[model samples]
Target: DAGVTQSPTHLIKTRGQHVTLRCSPISGHKSVSWYQQVLGQGPQFIFQYYEKEERGRGNFPDRFSARQFPNYSSELNVNALLLGDSALYLCASSFSERPPYFGPGTRLTVL
Candidate 1:
């Protein structure tokens, strides 16, 4: 069974630009969540979608958004990004709302 996968292993951008990160959850899973991990800190949850509905959201700003599709794949969009947004964007999946298995993440770098 394939595990969670993320696109563009690395990314670079400038301030105020928009970015979208993609993810595919484990086969047969229905929950997809997004998290942001800075240089020296743990991941901070962003958004979670199950059965294509918004289930939960973290303390992230409106600039951070995500959605899950029928196939359990998901996308995370960050609008008007800031330098502080430069971090690893992780995608996680779970069979239920419990703990999730994570992806390697898309390393985002902003200048």
Candidate 2:
């Protein structure tokens, strides 16, 4: 199965640099979610956008933002990166009320 696909599987950025991560959901899926997973911790939800509208958001700073496109793909943007931002960025796709299918995720390192 094609499943979900994410770009730039690995990334390196200096503190204060901004980054944009991309995700393509499985076909027919209308809900996309973004999550951040730090070392030794479970994935923390960042945002969930469904049907091109913001559905939910987690406890993150304003520097984090995301959008879902008409095609159901999504992009997660983070500005003014901090060392603590180093983690794995995960993308999940699913039907509006079903369990999600997660992508391999993008690993980011902030120096």
Candidate 3:
């Protein structure tokens, strides 16, 4: 079976620098979600997109946002990032609202 995939296993940035993470959902999947996992913490939902439209979002600042493409691929954009924003960004996919299968994630480090 096809599996969810994410890019750049690691990233490092400054306190005010911006970052972008990418992901590709499994074949036949229509929904993609973004999550943030800080060191030693569970993943936190950031956004969910289905059919190229945002379906859900978590409690994140305006600096965090994401979008899903027609092909079920996605991009997470973070702007004016803060040190607190440093975390592992994960991408997940599911056929329904049930628990999703996740990617290995892009670890973001902010100085």
- Quantify all predictions' global Cα lDDT against the true fold: 0.93, 0.97, 0.92
Tens digits of lDDT, candidate 2, 1-111: 699999989999999999999999999999999999999999999999999999999999999999999999999999999999999999999987999999999999999
Give per-model CA RMSD: 0.8, 0.5, 0.9
Write one digit per residue (lDDT tens) for candidate 1, span 1-111: 888999989999999999999999999889999999999999999999999999999998998888888888999999998999999999999998678999999999999
RMSD of 1: 0.8
In candidate 3, the residue pairs with backbone N, CA or C atoms under 3 Å apart (3 or more residues apart, or in different chains) clash, namely none
Q: Over the stretch 17-107, how does candidate 3's per-residue lDDT look in tens digits? A: 8898999998888999999999999999999999999999999999988988889899999999888988999999988777789999999
- Poorest stretch of ten by lDDT in candidate 3: 92-101
Number of the top candidate by TM-score?
Answer: 2
Candidate 3 TM-score over all chains jointly: 0.96
Q: By the lDDT metric, which is better: model 2 or model 3?
A: 2
Cand. 1 Cα-lDDT: 0.93
Scored against the true structure, residue 81 in model 3 reaches a CA lDDT of 84
Off by over 4 Å in 1: none
Ranking by lDDT: 2, 1, 3
